[model samples]
Target: MKNVLILGANGQIARIVAKRLLSEQADVQLTLYLRKSHRVDDLVAINSARVRTVDADIHDQEALDKAVQGQDIVFISNVDHDPDNELTQGVITAMIKNDVKRVIASNVLGIYGEVPGEYGRWNTEMLTQAGLNRARRSDELLEKSGLDYTTLRLPWLNDRDEVKYSITHKGESYVGVSGSRQSMADVVVKMIADPTYLNRESIGLADPDTQGLTRPVY
Candidate 1:
């Protein structure tokens, strides 16, 4: 059985991931870690034997450690609002203590400021430059933490259903400015089920041939 722990389980992406995992893979043992357990009552309603919910703050090292223990892989869908990447730090410490490897995290594009052309400048100026430095710091934390991690740097996320998307590596100049939330969830599920992405890598996800807007239009 593959033991998986999903931090920030109450978030939109994590919520989707939880349902998809349970529905798709019978052998996946998922522990959804959320700050507020009551927020996920709908999920618990599913009542699958392979599902577990944890209510604790990720910053609480002891509770985080307890959650990380006996998990083979960890996925982070949220982080604290601190620019110092305190949440990421807590996760790294807990994972190290529990000897857990393999992490998939949702990050944003332009963390490296590698988006080329006028769109790159626009992204850095009007879009990602606001308060996203904290996210970038978290990305840096994961990169140097010596864990087999994959950071899915996302573009403007839309609520539309699944669409054809493309994945780009770090320093490749992020393309396809927007991506569907379902597409991101699909990639996360793929990463969880397959072992082909064991090495540390940062991926940029987007649709094709379009410059994303400042925010997703519902």
Candidate 2:
């Protein structure tokens, strides 16, 4: 069975990923790591044999290490908020220590100033330089950390039920200013199911129909 560890399990996208994995992938086991374990208690109770929950801060080295052990893939479902990139660095350290090589992390777009046109300007104004810098540093850490990684640079998100989306590589201009949370979760599930799908690549995600909008659909 493929073992998957999902950090920040309480996040909206993370929760969707968890449910999809449980329902769709019979051969996978999961360790849901989050600050408040109770947030995923329903999953644990329903899928007791395949699901385990860890309740601890991401900065807690001991708990983090315990969660990382014996997992085949680590899914970082939350964005890095620490200016120093300590959270991302901590995850990298734990994964290296445990010899787990594959990771899929969530990040924001425009980190490389890749968004285009009026949307780009509006996105920049919305996210600000400081936030983008922190996200950029996190992605840089993963790229250099020697672990197999795929970073999803997401656009403004919505709760739309549809799964329509597209991908663009790191240097390509980010397209479609807004995408659904379901679309992002779908990408995560795809990566988890097939490890080599987007190996070592940082890609941007968006809904094709949402392109050219001056602002997010939401």
Point out the worst 10-residue segment of candidate 2 by lDDT: 38-47
* Residue 33 Cα positional deviation in candidate 2, in Å, after optimal superposition: 0.6
Maximum-TM-score candidate: 2
For 1-218, candidate 2 gives per-residue lDDT tens digits of: 99999999989999999999999999999999998799889888768999988889988998999999999999998899798998899999999999999999999999999998898888778888899999999999999999999999999999988999999998998879899999999999999999999999999999989888888997
lDDT of 1 by residue, 54-142 (tens): 89887888889999999988999874456667788888999988899888887877778866676666667764565468778888788
**Clashes (N, CA, C under 3 Å) per candidate:** 0, 0
The TM-score values for the models, in the order shown, are 0.90, 0.98
TM-score of 1: 0.90
Displacement of the residue 169 alpha carbon in candidate 1, Å: 0.4
Query: Cα RMSD to native, each candidate?
Result: 2.1, 0.8
Q: Evaluate all candidate structures by whole-model CA lDDT and list the values in order.
A: 0.80, 0.93
